[model samples]
Target: MKRMIVRMTLPLLIVCLAFSSFSASARAASEEKYWDHWIERHAQPLDASNASNKDLRFLKKVLKGKRIVQLGETTHGAGEINATKVRMIKYLHEELGYDVLAFESGFPDTNASYLNMDQLTPKSTMKNSIYAVWHTEDVVELFDYMKEQKEKGDPLILTGFDIQSMKNSFNVAATQWVKAVDPEKAELLSQSENDFSTLVTDSNTFDEFSQKKEKLVKNYQKLIKFTKTHASELKENLPKEPKAYEMFMHSLQLRIDVMETYMLEEMKEKLEEYPENIEDFSFFMRDRMMAEQFQWVADTLYPKKKIIVWGHNYHLRKQNTKMIKDWVQLNGPNMGDYLPERLKKQTYTIGIYAYSGASLDSSDNKTVKPVTSPPPSGSLEALLKAADRPAVFVDFLHTKNKKGTSWMYTPRTALYWGYMEEQMILKEQYDGVIWLEHITPSVIIK
Candidate 1:
């Protein structure tokens, strides 16, 4: 009787195991079917030119009533991503009425270049104002496009929202503004200008910068206080350029705030407080300042105009990941994360990624680094690559909570220069994603 009972139990256990295996296989097939259908239903093919911009018509519905649209790249060195962004910028400008194109570049230099865009060629304007990392052939094409539109009487105003003075252009531009506004006060700014130029261009490390931090802070404070004290007179002096005056004053204040924040980070280290990783304070402050600059653009400068923002995915992502939280415990919010609730509601962000490609190394922008391996199996890039499209844009807003695509809600990694990091909830991080099956390094403009 015991032997018979044992035999029966063993057979039943085998049957249960077989059924479980069948169920797992069936679930995987269903998921695959869902993803295939979803891609076919929603993926928009990316066109490189505005001539066939009908492919981008879907954006009209997705971005309806949006005031600010942010286009972000995984890295700064992808040629295809830059080309695709230019096409989107054209559509946003012509079809959607986004007239302002703000970059992740120097606030002072970019505005000065825009003010004198008529006198300068596109290449010169880009070279003098924007960061060298973005000095690519594809971006040059954008400057050319902006020039063409200005000629056609549909001007796309160029500006930037960064606090860091990337070049000496800022020093020249800022000093000129002060001289034009108040000649007597111009010398006060000149001192600060020289100090800042040295801080940005000469100091290569925090250690080097620390030695000059006190003097730089003192000079910047004096200049900022002087500017505030004579604000009304300065505005009156620039009667014909009230908006420019306001922006100039605000840029000066922001620069000082950035300097003070760096000083605070150094102080924290000296005090032996939050000693785990004090650099996070400076990183957080930079993004916070960037968000403030963007807000000033959206609310103060271009209140009625639609704006387009171009920047890195790391800076523009609205959501924070476990990695970021762990890494930046003191203050980890990104530029997008710092945006006010009202502006966030009216904003749409798109993150661009690639499954496989080579990119210019971020360290030097000259070294070519080939993608040594395919995207991880569960990454967002891998999922998109499985769709087998050369390039496609997937709208995360509409696809959430759908059948067979629950993977959208789950944590997954995304490719960054052919590498993966800790998983993040992709749907939360971006409103949409543009995936390139393959990419090449940006052609750096010499």
Candidate 2:
């Protein structure tokens, strides 16, 4: 009887100890499940301080046989993430043979142009010409990295609609569209086109937009020539004169002309309105171009490769995979929904975050802020405003101040609160998502 009792007690004690340990771990890991710190900190690598050694080890450990890594936003906000990224990239290319870096910040056509060595020569009207020449921060970093990779005889692939221009193409497209909807308005649209065209022609500064890259210059010239040829065909087919928005197959040519022309200026203009010209630009990129173009290039370029696009979170959404997902379940094109079940989790991942601890509003910080996701049906803006106890309006309507100090820009504060009450105003999707893992010296730690 004594021996049996001792055995029973020993078993009970072991069970109790196991339970206690699990409870502690559960408590600790609850944050990883709840808060997005680990993912967020990934924007900068933990091995940053000793990047050369750390990055090499990291690549070997994590990305040994990656086929695609569409994005890696290692800007780390304000601190210097470039050098660290360069080191990691060198490791990726030199050691692991991850050779390509695909950029979605440009149009596929532009990719062909860049490859062809097009001379930019931007028009005074099209603003993207400037950024294209000067290049945005990310663009510049990518260019530098690409150049270095090439010096090492490595391959690089670039893709995407050139920023605001994609969003801005809708304006020009709308002109053609509107004319189709209303026959009577053909003459009016023609007048608008004549006016816009005359302005473009008169602007000698049009050539001021230089095609810095040879491939881009060649592409531009090709597009210009294509536009002129297409314009003549559209004129020939139209009744009297082509109405601005005629729904004919030939109108695609007109659409392309409008896109390339506006591409020249979308970023140059101040476009804060909903029905603005910029919207026209965006529509052209989203609605007309084949998303397959980018996907095909990515598939070929990667081929058992691991890459990091460094694009906005929206592009990564594997959930609502395609622009057409809202309409079709299994049909049409949407990468977000089509990822294999295993890859789905990583592929369609996204990180919803609050980027604190930095002066996030600088023009240089353009890559970080604006929260990638748009205000969902005005809910984000609405909820943010309503929850703001001391809500401040800047110019009243269109934009509300975040809170505390309205000097140059309003700072975002506790508005992330609404997500708690299940009253979260908006729920945006993410693809290949993770949050910042650690607070860097450049940003403040909340």
Candidate 3:
């Protein structure tokens, strides 16, 4: 009698285990279906030349009342991401009222491009001011569109917020502006420009910059002094371009602050036997300054206009902490994280990610290689792909709290710089995400 009872109980236990597995699978399918309902499947990532805004009409509601929209990419070398950004930028400028398009590039260089847009060709303006990583055919098309719009009486302003100097545009623009106002004072600026240019072109790393810290600091100080002393004359001479002069002064001061911060971090690294949080010191300073520079653009430069920010995902995400190498902690707050409360309330961040295929790896900006891989199991990219869409935009901010979308609130793996997986809560990091089923290398223009 005891053996018969045990046999019947074992069968009952097996049936219960089978039912549990089936129920879990059913829940997962239900969750995926829920995500599918919120996914905008009609949108396509097209460049300005090929885009039609009918599919993008959805953005009007998504970005309503948002003064600044930051567009982020997984890497700098994805062709689809660049094309998608150009299309969105065109939509923002034409359909919406966003007039300023800011980049993650040199402040002075990009402004110089804007001031001289009529004199310089679109391609030349892009190459001279924007960073080389963005020197792609897609961006050139967008530049062409900007010029076209300018010719038609509507203008889209181009600017940047980075502290690092780019090319020789800053040096040329600074000296020329001073000469036009006060010829005698131009000599002092020219000398500082010469020194600063050497520091910009010669140094590509922290150690190199550290070696020239004293000279770098001195040059910026002298430049700042000249700008302050002759502010009246400079503004008076350029009545039509008063904002230009103001921004130039702001750039000089911001650059010096950034350099000083770097120098202090370097000093600590050298003096301390064990620097506890030295690994991310420069990144912290850079991101903080970038945020401040962006704020200046919004509040001071284009106070009444909506703005678009173009940058990498790592720099634009809202979260402050991340784990590197699965052990080491990264506590550096990104540019988005450092944004002021006022701006944060009106900002919408969108991150670009790919499900599979090769991304161009131009880490050194010299030789390009391909990083080919598929999304790992249980990654955000994988989950999006499971929705069975070639391309989609998930509006996490609006849908994450809905029933069956609880998966978005939990930590999940996502591809980051160099296609490495990092775990983050999707809804917390970005307002929305553009996911591509496959991506190819960006067309690098020579």
C-alpha RMSD of candidate 2? 18.5
Clash count, candidate 2:
71
Global Cα RMSD, each model: 7.6, 18.5, 8.1
What is the C-alpha lDDT profile of model 3 across 2-70, one tens digit per residue?
999999999998999999868755665567656544443423332234346676777899898899999
lDDT minimum window of 10 residues, candidate 3: 322-331
Q: How do all models score by TM-score? A: 0.82, 0.41, 0.82
In the predicted model 1, the residue pairs found to clash are none
The top-ranked prediction according to TM-score is 1
lDDT of 3: 0.74
Worst 10 residues of 2 by lDDT: 417-426
Q: Can you write out model 1's per-residue Cα lDDT over 264-375, one digit (the tens) per residue?
A: 5645545544535433666676777888889889999889989999998878877653333222343257787788999998899999988888888767889987753577
TM-score attained by model 1: 0.82
Among these predictions, the greatest lDDT belongs to 1
Question: What TM-score quantifies how close candidate 3 is to the native fold?
Answer: 0.82
Task: Sort by lDDT, best first.
Answer: 1, 3, 2
